[model samples]
Every structure is written in C-alpha cells, then in structure tokens.
Target: MRKRLLTEVEGVVAAPVERVWRALLDDRPAYEMTTELGDHTVAYQGGWWYRGEWSVTAHPEGARVVLRVYNVADRLGWGVPLANRFFVGFGARTRQTFAEGLTALGERLGCPSRLLP
Candidate 1:
C-alpha cells in the first residue's frame, strides 16, 4: 500500500519578502521557532529543504507567503501484518502533528494560524 500526505500553509506578513526571508533563513529566530514548535533542530541539507527528519518549505513572494510539508513514515508490522498496516495507514497521530506544527510555525511568523484545505 502507498499513501502520501500533503500539507500547505499560507499567510501574509506585514513585512516584505526579504525581511520575512531573513527572519526565516537566519538561524536565530528559525532555531528558536523550531524548538518552540517542538522540532529538535532545523537544517538546510539541500536547496529549499529543512532537515530535522521533519520538513517545512517556505515560498515567499512579495508580501505573500506559502509553506508546504510532505511527511512519510513507514509502519512495518508483524503478526497480522495486513491489519496492523491498515491501522497504521489511517491514524490520527501523524495528522495531528502536522497540523499543530504548521499552525505553530505560522503563529511564530506573525501569520494567522490556519490549516489549509
């Protein structure tokens, strides 16, 4: 079985993209925000990628802002493997983590907190 999770976060900042970008890309606030969001650390392993075994993507265009996250977790099961897989496939924990994490980030960035549809 294969499943994909997609989450989008969008907002507007009173400041310009450059200012917002600095606040985001610069280590100080970003690190603080990560910890506040329960993230252990935030690192850029590749272009436009934040590595902490967790992900958050920022797309800042003018005063508009967007963040997208894609998370994949493998759940391998033993003993009644099929049923266990199904149980893990549709669970609330991962969903809740994504929602809360994104909302907290948005709030930290001075954006209205919301869950994108």
Candidate 2:
C-alpha cells in the first residue's frame, strides 16, 4: 500500500477555468501513473513516492488553481518527517515554485494571478 503525505497550495487567476486547465495540461510532468479526476482535475503519480494533482475551478474573481503534492511512499514512509527536517524545505520550496508558476501562467494568459492566504 502507498502512504500519502500531502502538501497543498492554491492561487487565483483572472481567467476562465478552461484556460487555466489548458495551461496546466501543457506544463504537466511525466509521471508513472495518471488519474483524470474530471474535466477540471488531473493527478500524476511518479517515482517511488510522488503524486501531484492539479485542478481549476470557478472563483469570484476568475479561476482558482489548486496544486497538491503527496509523498505516496510504498516503503519507508515513516522516514518522511525526518527527511523533511534534515533534507529539504519541502513545503517552502513548493510554495515558492507554485508562486512562480502562477506568475508565469498569469503572464502567459495575459491575466493577473495571486496566491491565496
């Protein structure tokens, strides 16, 4: 069985959900496993313990983009906490990267984008 340890971040873009979805598809990573949740959501699982999910939904300003990352480790799952503290700033890095992505997406779509609190 795989154990999932989740970290999430979200942002809003001043564009249609379809546009955001298309952009997400264009930049998706190549993963070992894929799950299509719906027209607006997709998930990819790869490596020994990585899964990423992306989704777009309607928001008051425009479209909301959500990104979720999971450590889906089949083995040594319990080591994640130790690794997180000693090896990498996982959550911080994810947030920084996601913020950059949102900025780039906004530039691509000619719309404004911002991370949610």
Candidate 3:
C-alpha cells in the first residue's frame, strides 16, 4: 500500500509568454516541459507518479503557470485522495516550492514576474 499528495495552484507571471516559458522551462520548444529540481525531475507538465503536472499558458502581456501534483496510493481503502487531505502540509510545501520556483525562474530569465496571491 502507498499514498500520495496532489495540489493545484496557479500564479501569474508579468512577462511575455515566450520569455516566461524560456525562463522556467529552459526554452523548451513545447508547452509540455520538465523542471529540474537538483537531480530529480519531480515536476513535469504531463504528470507523473508522486510528481506534478505543470502547465503554462499565455495571458495578456504575460503568462500563467498551473501546477497539479498527485499520486495513486493504497495507504487505506480510501486511497490517495484521503491521504492527500490528511497531509495538508504537503500541499502547503508544494505551493511554496512552486512559488519559489516561479520567482527563481523570473530572476534567471532576467525578467521579473509578480506572483499573484
């Protein structure tokens, strides 16, 4: 039996879509991309086990990033959904992690992005 957590949060970037994409995604050609957090590619656009589904879309004068992290589990008969709810800390941490990542991405790209609360 196993369990996982999934959290969904969105933030706005005050830079052009292309620029934001390049910065956060290392200039990947497609919207589907992976994030390198040290040696682990824990974040991805397409979703993975215990990982996250990361998406980027263009908005007026900027872009928006959406993250959904989840996993399948058997911790109980209730499965991953119940586990996720019980572990609220994971969601909070995920939010902060993504927020920081977005901020760092903007800095690395040389175009600052404002994270919408």
> Evaluated with lDDT, which candidate comes out highest?
2
Q: Once superposed on the true structure, which residue ranges of model 1 sit more than 4 Å away at CA?
A: 1-5, 27-62, 72-117
TM-score of each: 0.34, 0.87, 0.62
For model 3, where is the 10-residue window of minimal lDDT?
Answer: 38-47
RMSD (CA, Å), candidate 3 to true, equals 7.3
Q: How high is the CA lDDT of each candidate model? A: 0.41, 0.84, 0.62
1 versus 3: better lDDT goes to: 3
**Candidate 3 Cα outliers beyond 4 Å, as residue runs:** 1-5, 27-48, 73-77, 81-88
Task: Provide the global lDDT of candidate 3 against the true structure.
Answer: 0.62
Candidate 1 has a TM-score of 0.34
lDDT of 1 by residue, 8-70 (tens): 444444444555555554433333323323232233222222222232334443344444343
